[model samples]
Target chain A: VDAGALDAARSRDASLTKPPGSLGQLEDLAIWYAGWRGERPKLEAPQILIFAGNHGVTAQGVSAFPPEVTAQMVANFNAGGAAINQLARCFGARIDVHPITLDRPTGDFTEGPAMTEAELLEALSLGWAAVDPAADLVIAGEMGIGNTTSAAALAAAMFGGNPRDWVGRGTGVDDEGLARKAAAVAAGLARHRGELLDPLEALRRLGGRELAAMAGAIAAARSHRIPVILDGFICTAAAAVLERIAPGALDHAIAGHQSEEPGHARLLGALGKRPVLTLGLRLGEGSGAAVALGVLKAAIACHSGMATFAEAGVADGPG
Target chain B: VDAGALDAARSRDASLTKPPGSLGQLEDLAIWYAGWRGERPKLEAPQILIFAGNHGVTAQGVSAFPPEVTAQMVANFNAGGAAINQLARCFGARIDVHPITLDRPTGDFTEGPAMTEAELLEALSLGWAAVDPAADLVIAGEMGIGNTTSAAALAAAMFGGNPRDWVGRGTGVDDEGLARKAAAVAAGLARHRGELLDPLEALRRLGGRELAAMAGAIAAARSHRIPVILDGFICTAAAAVLERIAPGALDHAIAGHQSEEPGHARLLGALGKRPVLTLGLRLGEGSGAAVALGVLKAAIACHSGMATFAEAGVADGPG
Candidate 1:
């Protein structure tokens, strides 16, 4: 964070016409944004990257939708017919859909590692290269039928929680499917025990290609000083790998929303990230982050647009 | 509200490409908005009315700022320099500021009634007339130095709560100012005990002109089928008067945000309102509601703009 820029923003916020600290979280958020975009920031180009890949764990009956739905959703995204497309339109953000080998599903983590080293590298490089350097903000989302199960396994392995605690009803799974998801998570952990010690190794072993790609995109965003809005459970779990590998790696990121998934709250708690919105959103594809994009815009609009008390000729109240 | 429109929106939501309830509160908010604007709604015209008044209760030292600051802020608003102005620009909303008798402050509620019946009616009429019938959405906000004290007294008189519970650090009041606010609230309730049995009488006795104006504007919005986004503590207290007199009078209104004021949560609970945003905002110039406008716009955009599963040629999951 740019300490000078943040201090300048704080001083400017106090000088605004309204009472000091009356805007609450918005004040802090604007300063945080200013830290990245300088004292006066404009959110002109926010990019939404949705990485889709097929999950082999869907064959274990761990999700409501079949694996083919991943590619179908990717096509839907490409056609600008998905929920994220509407949200992108709402924020005037550009949307990019990357389908990472939907024809070849990752190895079922319950049997072995989800991705080979080369496969993980390919997805990561694709995501790393996909970022637009000119974009002011980035939102990384994922689409995979059984990716939430993979997310739960990754979170449980990374944070040392019970598999059942990290599992949730992904894509409206029934009780049977929920149990199957938990079993799949536990099996994945058992199959890849010592190999999961390294966080990147954990991503290769337990996370799908789309998940690794999200991690890569988040890291790329950090490298470019583009603040990121982390999406739902799968997206956060992907970003969690980066945080585990290097502390403070996600300083440029903020959680978009606390999803309906139960593990989402636990993961956010572990990450010490308070989401910008909490409308019980669980639909991935960067929808929650896309929704929160308006909030960040509003915050910045108030910060840069509103006249200070001295300029407005308004009396400053004594605290 | 139009029941047919709401039902149509609900039906349309289920057919969208995402899971049935994956959108969560946004799905419900869009359906409610549809109830007011019909099944196909466009939120192009959102009008924000800010009512400013001077409160005599400031003589009791119940606020951080002097009462004269009300007129100064009103001038700031007129110059398009206030926080609400920036938010209005962000949403393309029009703002009309009405300063009611700022030269002649309302009578101190602790000493006597805040306004006579005629004075209350004048403020109410001004607010009712301020609403633009062509507007698709309305937001009512208030600006008064000691208005939170008036709001606390009104809430205490109407809802039978401890005055201390309703009193909060409005605009960064210190401990001494908070105590004075609570004492004033208790005195106002005691002085107008029998008169406040009627809700409108409570507004006349304990509420300031700005609060009554907000109540009037909210009622007018409801009459026009223009859904309202109620602001912080003072604004909600004003709307609460309508709900008290006529049960479900605020059916067209939704809370925009939970403010930093502690009483707001209790009042929202009593009114059966779940705020769309909880950013700890304490500014009373309709700023909270103005910030939440983006959230509503995003919801409506997703509801109306996203493609249905059949339209997108995507496979619908079992969910």
Candidate 2:
């Protein structure tokens, strides 16, 4: 973090017409932007990159939707017809859909590793290459039918938590499907217990192609000095992996919302990030992150637009 | 609430590309608008009315800022120099500054009633008249020094909570000022215990002129069929009063954010309203509500703009 920029933002916040710290987290948000940009924060040309892939875990019938739905949703996103599309339109954000592969799905983690080491590296490269240099802010979203099971498996293995504790009904699955999902996660963790010791190997073993891509995108965004906004559970799981692989990579990222998914809160807590919005969102087409763009815009606008106490001739409170 | 419009909205939400409850509170917010408008919700010509007044309780040193700061901030708001002004500009909402009385602060409620019954009624009328008929949405904000003490007093009297439990550091007051504020609240509650049984009497006794005006504006907006977005702690206190005096008056209103003020959550809870934003905001003057306008807009847009599964040729999940 840029200490000088953060100090400058704090000084500016104190000079604002309202009481110091009265804006609460907004003041911190503005300061965070300053620290990220190392100057006055400006939000312009924000981009939403949706990474879509198929999860082989769906063969276990753990998800409410079939794996084909992933491709269909990606098409919907490209056609400007999905939730993320509407949110992007509302926020004036540009959206990009990148399908890792249409024909091939990752191997079922319960049976074996989700992806070969080379495939994982290629997906990561694809993610790294997807960043738009002109973009001021980047939001990473994911689409995969059984991605939640893979995410749960990754989180369970990485965090060493019970699979049942991390597993949740993805896409409003029935109780039977939820049970199957949790069981699949437990099996995957047991099968990859030794491989999970290494974060990269764990990701290759349990994480999906979209997860790898998102993790790469996040690390790339940080390297490019562009802030990243993470979507819900699946996206945060990817972020957790990135954090383990690259310590402090999340300094450029923020969680968008607390999803209805059970593991989202734990993942965000592990990342040391607090979501700006909490509306029980569970859809994972980058909708939550896209929706949060409004708050970010408002915070930036207030930070840059409001007059100082001296400028407004308003009396400052006596602390 | 318009049941017909709400039903239509629910039907529309069901047809959207995502699951029925995937959008969570956003889906409910869109339905709220439909009910408010009795048709498709349109958020055009939004107006933010800021009611500024002074509290004689400031003489007791319950606030970090002096009473004069209220009028000064009002002038700053008129000059487009305050946080609310910046927020309004960002959200494309019109702002109106209404200064109740610069010279005459409300009576110290610890000693007596803040206003006479007639004065309270007049202040409410002023608030009601402040709403523009052309406004599609109304937001009420308050600017009053030491008003949190007054609000805490009202809430304590109405809800039977301990004064210390409801009092918090207003405007970043130190420990000493918080203690003084709490003591003053307890005293005011003790003095007006009998009068508090009647909600109107409670407002006249413990509420500031800005609070009365806000309550009036909220009631008037509902009457005018313009949904109201309430600001932080002080603003929601007025809504609580409105709810007591006129049952279901708050059905047309939604909380903007959960303020850092300790009593805000309790006040919002009493009204059965969940704030959309939780930025720890304690600043009054409708800053929270103005910032939240962006989210409301996005929710409305997504509710109306997203293509249904049928339209997008996307398959729905099997539950």
Best by DockQ: 1
Error of 2 at B259 (Å): 1.1
Please write out the lDDT profile of model 2 over residues B1-319, one tens digit for every residue. Answer: 8778889988988998887798999998888988888655678799999898888888788988877788788888888888888788777899888899868889999899999988899899999999998898999998888999998998887778788888999887889999999889988988876778988889899998889999888888988899888888888888888788777878899998888898999988988999999998888889899878888888888888888888987888652
Q: Which regions of candidate 1 fall more than 4 Å away from where they truly are? A: none
Q: What's model 1's lDDT at B50?
A: 94
- Residue-wise lDDT of candidate 2 within A1-319, one digit each (tens)? 7788889888887788888778888777777877888666788789999999998888899888777788888888888888888788877899988999858999999999999989999999999899998788999999888999999988887787788888898798889988999899888988877779888788899998999999888888888888888899999999888788778878888888999999999888887899999999999988899878888887887888888888988778652
DockQ, every prediction: 0.70, 0.66
What do the candidate models score in CA lDDT, each in turn? 0.91, 0.86
- RMSD to native for every prediction? 1.1, 1.8
Query: What local lDDT does model 1 show for residue A136?
Result: 96
Tens digits of per-residue lDDT for model 1, B196-282: 889998899888899989999999999899999999999999999999999999999999999999999999999999999999999
